[model samples]
Target: ELKVEQNPLFLSMQEGKNYTIYCNYSTTSDRLYWYRQDPGKSLESLFVLLSNGAVKQEGRLMASLDTKARLSTLHITAAVHDLSATYFCAAEPSFNNDMRFGAGTRLTVKP
Candidate 1:
């Protein structure tokens, strides 16, 4: 089984600031994915890290993974009120691809 951990479950940031959310897994996997969700909404895929050092960026959000360490990260740059939402990371566990998800980080960006 795979265990996933995420830090800073809640974040409040001012517009124009920067922050990062981290994800750690207890087991090995080749695939990691990041997602975003707004209140009363469904998950929206933001990134897909398929290998070591894989990274993806869209607008103010960036995501990366280190397969050797079973770690992934989501970086937010130049915060904006519109960016307020919850973020999650999921991993394909132990090569079984069973899939496990992090607890999620809720970010509130203020102007």
Candidate 2:
């Protein structure tokens, strides 16, 4: 079974601040994906980290994975109010081909 964990279930930040959300998995995973969700909106993919030490970035968000550690991180730089949303990290475990997602990190960027 693949289990995923995330920390800082909630975050409140001021504009221009920086923060990082973490994702840890219990088993070996060959792929990881980061997604963002806004109120009443569907999920939007932000990054697709495919291999060990793989990293992807778009806008103020960056995501990376370390396959050996079964861990991934989403770094937010210079946060803006428009960045407020929920972020989720998902992983597909090689053992079972099942995908699991971490509990979302809800972020609120205030002015």
Candidate 3:
């Protein structure tokens, strides 16, 4: 059985601060995706880390994957109110098409 875990499920920070969200999986995964969901909105793909040590960044968000450790991280730099949303990480194993999502981390950026 494959399992995913995310820490600091709820985060509250002031604008312009920096934070990181972590995703750890129990087994080997080929890739990982980071997503963001606003209130009452659909999930938006933020970043896709494809290979070991793969890193992707867009705007204030950056994502990295360490396949050997079975871990991934999403880093937020100089966060803004618009970035306040629920963030999720999904891992896709090499075996099948199945993807497992970690418990989302709900973030709130205050002014």
Candidate 4:
């Protein structure tokens, strides 16, 4: 079974500040994905990290995966109010073909 843990469930940041959200998984995974969800909105795909040390960035967000450590990170640079949302990280293990997701991190960017 695969399990995921995300820390600091809630974050409040000022605009122009930076932060990083972490996702840790138990078990080996080769594929990982990041997603964003706004209040009352469906999830939006952010990034797909396919290999160890893989990194992807879009806008002010960057996601990276470390397969060997069973961990992934999402870094937000120069956060903006428009970036406020809930973020989730999911990992798919090679053995079971199943994906497990972290509890999610809710971020609020203030002006």
lDDT per residue for candidate 3 within 2-110, as digits (tens), equals 7999987999999999999999999988779998999899999998888999999899999999999999999999999999999999988889979989999999999
Model 3 scores what on Cα lDDT?
0.92
Clashes per candidate, residues 3 or more apart or on different chains: 0, 0, 0, 0
Which digits, one per residue and each the tens of the lDDT, describe model 1 over residues 1-111? 888999989999999999999999988886898989999999998888888988899999999899888889899999999999999999886458588889999999999
lDDT tens string, model 4, 1-111?
A: 889898779999999999999999998887898989999999899999999889998999999988888889999999999999999998888887788889999999999
Clashing pairs in 3: none
**Candidate 4 TM-score, C-alpha based:** 0.96
Tens-digit lDDT string for candidate 2 (1-111): 888999888999999999999999998888898889998999998888989999888889889899999889999999999999999999997766688889999999999
Q: Give the range where candidate 2 is weakest over 10 consecutive residues by summed lDDT.
A: 92-101
Q: What is the alpha-carbon lDDT for the whole of candidate 4?
A: 0.92
Work out how many backbone clashes candidate 2 has: 0
Which scores higher on lDDT, 1 or 2?
2
Task: Pick out the ten consecutive residues of candidate 3 with the lowest summed lDDT.
Answer: 1-10
Return the TM-score for candidate 2, rounded to 2 decimals: 0.95
Ranking by lDDT: 3, 4, 2, 1
lDDT per model, in order?
Answer: 0.90, 0.91, 0.92, 0.92
Cα error, residue 16 of model 1, in Å, equals 0.3
